[model samples]
Target: MTDFDLPEEFDEENIVSKTSIKRDMHKLQALGKRLTELKPNQLEKVPMSETLRKAIDESQRITQREATRRHMQYIGKLMRAEDAEAIQNAVDLFDASSKAFAQALHSLERWRDRLIEGGNETLSEYIHDNPNADIQHLRQLVRNAKKDLKNEKNTGASKKLFRYLRTIDDMDNETTP
Candidate 1:
């Protein structure tokens, strides 16, 4: 009935076995060693804000639009269940033309970057004192480049290339006959 007294049925050896104590101590030591061996480098954490989420969404939208444009280009060239064998050659030529145009556009980004930097007050001021020149020169240059690109796209050279490609295709078809 006292604090140190146990019931007649209680057994001390069963309650605190040496084997169980050794197993528990071994597990704790193994965990401690694993924790000590794992040394992580400096943590650089940047909390994602609302502004970042909006920017990411905008970027994904642009990527999706570009992907759709590329898919349409693919459809126009290769899908023959929309079947017209006669125009397949023309479609292939068109795909090459579109690809070149895209490359030119990628190159034009450099010009845009140049314009952003060169459209400056110091440059404009020098041109302004002279009545023959104007501050709108940067705009004029960009407009002229665009007009030239448009003209190049509509030139007879592209037409001639397509016609030549069609002839080669027709010759190929006729040879198998």
Candidate 2:
């Protein structure tokens, strides 16, 4: 038989080749590196085996480059024995949520800047977008923020505006299905 030919019992589709195994190990190591970069709270959301978690924690503590690389390889080995798919899904979800949060924060910042710079026109547009928003409170905060900017104060009003935007964001999240 040729080198490419398989035995009757060996299903090519079901059998993992050496190259595929190596590729999968590299993918797992990449995921492990991503997990190690996460903050403690963010890492908590990703479901992982206890051993894998310990390995990741150890990897984080290691300062030496070669040692960290070896530890990451060990993590990849442990990952090979666990449910890599599920772990990957959890990490993807976390990444998506964080990205959404960043987008929302940027949107809020844009709105705040518009309120301070664009004056009545931008305020009207904002009110049109958020009908349930407290017009009086928003106007007050915007006025204070603009005044603080003009007078070169500590910009406490800007911080208050940010907090108000965050509350609105929280309310919107709660109301969404």
Candidate 3:
């Protein structure tokens, strides 16, 4: 069997053309002009990886296959096993954390809605029966209930509870005298 040999395209020597000495000077002059024209923001752009720039620069003078192999080699050295493991752990934590938070928020909203509903129902019943009640007192209780109801839909419970609490408070004040 014949030995497995890579194609000439993958060989660096097959790709790089020796620059004529006179042309090399011209290339350097053009590179200098391009560098001077770069804006400050353009200069500040950070590379994804420092070696990426070197790999791209090398590609211009080498076979595409050789350039890719060199880039992969550079990247392999830059990545650490520990950092990869840590990133995986962080991603897992974010997923679990967000799910737990959403569930907790849903549970809390249900609890608040129940309280407001019950309060509304009781308050409404009390106000209906006590027509002669102090207008100021009744108004205060209703205003507070209105605010809560705005946050939640008005239901029997919220009306009843608000009226009930106010009626009880008013009765206690009247009895004290």
Candidate 3, TM-score vs. the true structure?
0.19
Task: Give one digit per residue, the lDDT tens place, for model 1 in 1-177.
Answer: 999888999987679778986675454333322222222210001122334323323333444766644533333332222223322232332243556445544444443434334545534543453334333654455444445456665444333333433443334433432
The TM-score between candidate 2 and the true structure equals: 0.52
RMSD of 2: 7.1
Off by over 4 Å in 2: 1-6, 96-177
Q: Candidates' lDDT values, in order? A: 0.39, 0.82, 0.44
Flag the better candidate by TM-score, 1 or 2.
2
The number of the candidate with the highest TM-score is: 2
User: How would the candidate models be sorted by lDDT, starting from the highest?
Assistant: 2, 3, 1
Residue ranges of candidate 1 with Cα displaced over 4 Å: 1-14, 41-177
lDDT (10s digit) by residue, model 3, range 16-125: 45576436444433332232233433322322233433433443455587655554444334432124333233222223355544554454345334444456564455
| lDDT at 100, model 2 | 53
Model 3 ranges with Cα > 4 A deviation: 1-97, 120-177
Clash count in backbone of candidate 3: 25
Ranking by TM-score: 2, 3, 1
